[model samples]
Target: MSSKVIHAIYTDDDLLMQAVKQTREANYHIEEVYTPFPVHGLDKAMGLAPTRLAITSFLYGLVGLSVAISMMNFIMIQDWPQDIGGKPSFSFLENLPAFVPIMFELTVFFAAHLMVITFYMRSKLWPFKQAENPDVRTTDDHFLMEVSVGKHNVKDMSKFLSDTGALEVNLINK
Candidate 1:
């Protein structure tokens, strides 16, 4: 069965937040919200679950640290032991202090690069992807809230959204 949706456009972020809260309180399902910039606390306002990107970043950093340690051990100790400034070329642990910079740099590099890749994959933001925003204005200076109209009265929803400071309300079928 085809479903109907209500698109509420708000000019202000504050008003959008208030509308989202009111909509949630009134038992409406918010499908999504598109804004020009990231709206602080908008996820919480929409009752979304917290993200787990930090955990992934930590894992990526650990991988990078492991690679750095192994690479440094192979190159410095096993492959060709170096005698810089007459330092002892004995153990990996003994020369770990010198590899601290490489370890730190690799950790940060992997964490940053992998986190960005993970974010892009999670958000389905691949290169050359078409924009999925319903309203072009939302890309510039508007905030759009998409409310699913499952068993909800469209007229009442439109009126309620307008009352909640929506500048415009439009119905879409899908």
Candidate 2:
């Protein structure tokens, strides 16, 4: 069966939370939620899982730091040792402080790049994907709740939404 989406627009946070509670009470499955800005406790209210991006970013940053250290150590010590002002250059232990800048830069660089890419991929926000929003107002000043429903329950869901203070509601067929 094809999935049909019902989009509910809300202007009031309390009303929106109530609607979400009611939807859960009715056993409706929420597809996604959109808000112009973050709402406190919204994720828990929607029963969404905590994101794992932070851990992934940390791991990637560690890998980048290790690579930077090894590369810098090998190049500056073993491959080509350059003496400036009669300073000794050997392994990383000899000049550990000198590599701090490169290590920090690489760590931040990898964390930022990999975290962003991971978030984009996890959210399925690749290029050329058409906007899933049914209403443009939701992107600016409104909160949107997308729910998948059966054809038979469309009217009932719409009525519930209207009763629960939805500013607007639309049904999209997949």
- C-alpha lDDT values of all predictions: 0.95, 0.86
- Please tell me which predicted candidate would have the highest TM-score against the true structure: 1
lDDT string for model 1 (47-103, tens) is 999999999999999999999999988888999887889996779988878899999
Model 1, 24: alpha-carbon shift in Å?
A: 0.3
How many steric clashes between backbone atoms does each model show? 0, 0
User: What residue pairs are clashing in model 2?
Assistant: none
Q: TM-score, each model? A: 0.96, 0.88
Off by over 4 Å in 2: none
Model 1 Cα shift for residue 99 (angstroms)? 0.7
- lDDT of model number 2: 0.86
lDDT tens digits, residues 20-119, model 2?
Answer: 8888788888888888778888888888899888899999999889989888978999899888578778656878888899999999998999899999
Backbone clashes (count) for model 2: 0
Off by over 4 Å in 1: none
TM-score: model 1 vs. ground truth = 0.96
